[model samples]
Target: MRRYGPALLLVLVGAAILRISAFSALYLRYVQAGLRPYLIVSGAALVLLGIAMAVVRRSADDAHDDDGDPLDHEHGHAHHGPRVAWLLTLPALALLLFPPPALGSYSAEREAAQRAAQGVGVFPALPAGDPVELGVGEFSSRAIYDSGRSLKGRTVRMTGFVTHGDDGTWYVTRLLVSCCAADAGTSKAEIRGADALPADTWITVTGTWHPKGKLGTDAAWPPVLDATSVERVEQPADPYEKR
Candidate 1:
């Protein structure tokens, strides 16, 4: 049985990878799409390794059984290690049972003081359109520091989960990730006349950006949106914004 220990771990780990990547957006919540292929390959490799280990163990057992020595059974040629190795499966099981959700309002609140340092390039010119669709992170980033003040006249649309502040303020918040959730940063904009939606509810607010104070200030500064309309919306498949 001890020989099977490595096999058990491989199978469990592999199953966990496949389980999460196959059906759930678990990978997306933590990492980017480029990792999905690697995850699948790793899972398949682990399962194959486990199966190979089991086959070798069975062959060894059969070889031992073929020996004419009856004492072979009592001699205990098998080495089934301690049960503690089973703990490895807990994470896999949890990934299956609970499936952790993406960072939400609580996370945004905790990171309120930290804003995205200058994102990828000069904020790209708003693509030609009325009520341009914009990511929460982009809106927040530009609002705070873009010298051009691009959002001033644009009727922009941003989608994210709602969050309530300690001061009874509402914000549309989204996390920005350079690579994965491990490196996640937060972006947010204060909302006015939000229709008082419950916190953590997903919504798309279409409106215009109005300057509050100086752009690009300290943590106290945030992009403000005077929402012309607020409505509950479904959560998008990929929720995080790429910074």
Candidate 2:
């Protein structure tokens, strides 16, 4: 068993990857959808390599046994692998049995300062509607930089996990990722008129924009929403927005 440790570890990690990427949509928690095919291929390759290694090792052991001298038979085959190497499997097992939840309020809060947009400019007109659905990142962009005030009178709906601030302040927050969770950045809107929800709770907020400070300034950051309704909802399949 000890001799097969490396193969076991490989198989376990590969299976965990397959469990998240091929068997379900859980990969979205950590990476973009475009990466699914690569993950699936990687997982399959690991599994195959592990099986090949195990088979080759087993065959070698059998051949060694068949030609062994009487003196050699009296002694046992020694496994020199370090016992600490088994610890490496823990993370694979954890991923297989209990995959971590998507990044939430804690991750959002870690970004103490927000990055500013390029510059204030006119954004394309939004489609004609009463309550337009918007992404938290897009909303933040328009609120902070759009000279056109595209959101001024429109009722908009945005969904994200709730995050609380210092004071009694709370926000509907979304993490934007370019490639994966490691590069995730936070985008959020301060909610007014609605009661704060528990941290990490998913919610759909309907509100109108509440402009702040001059556009293109730090003061306008985070933006503001005068929420008319706050409805708890399940987290989306793909939680992070494209940066």
How many residue pairs clash in model 1? Answer: 3
Cα deviation at 29, candidate 2, in Å, is 0.4
lDDT of 1 by residue, 1-243 (tens): 565777877888788888777766678888777788888888889889999989988887787788857788546574567778777778867876777888888787787475445532346688888789989877877777777777778899989999888888888888888788888877888999656688789999999987876656674367789999987898887788887
lDDT of 1: 0.80
TM-score for all predictions?
0.89, 0.96
Candidate RMSDs in Å, in order, are 2.5, 1.5
Predicted model with the maximum lDDT: 2
Clashes of each: 3, 0
* lDDT of model 2, residue 82: 89
Tens digits of lDDT, candidate 2, 1-243: 887888999999999999999999999999999999999999999999999989988987787789777656445466547899999999999999999999999999989765844788999999898799999999999999999999999999999999999988999999999999999999999999988999999999999999999999889987999999999999999999999
For residue 85, what is the lDDT in candidate 2? 92
Given candidate 2, what's the lDDT at residue 24?
A: 100
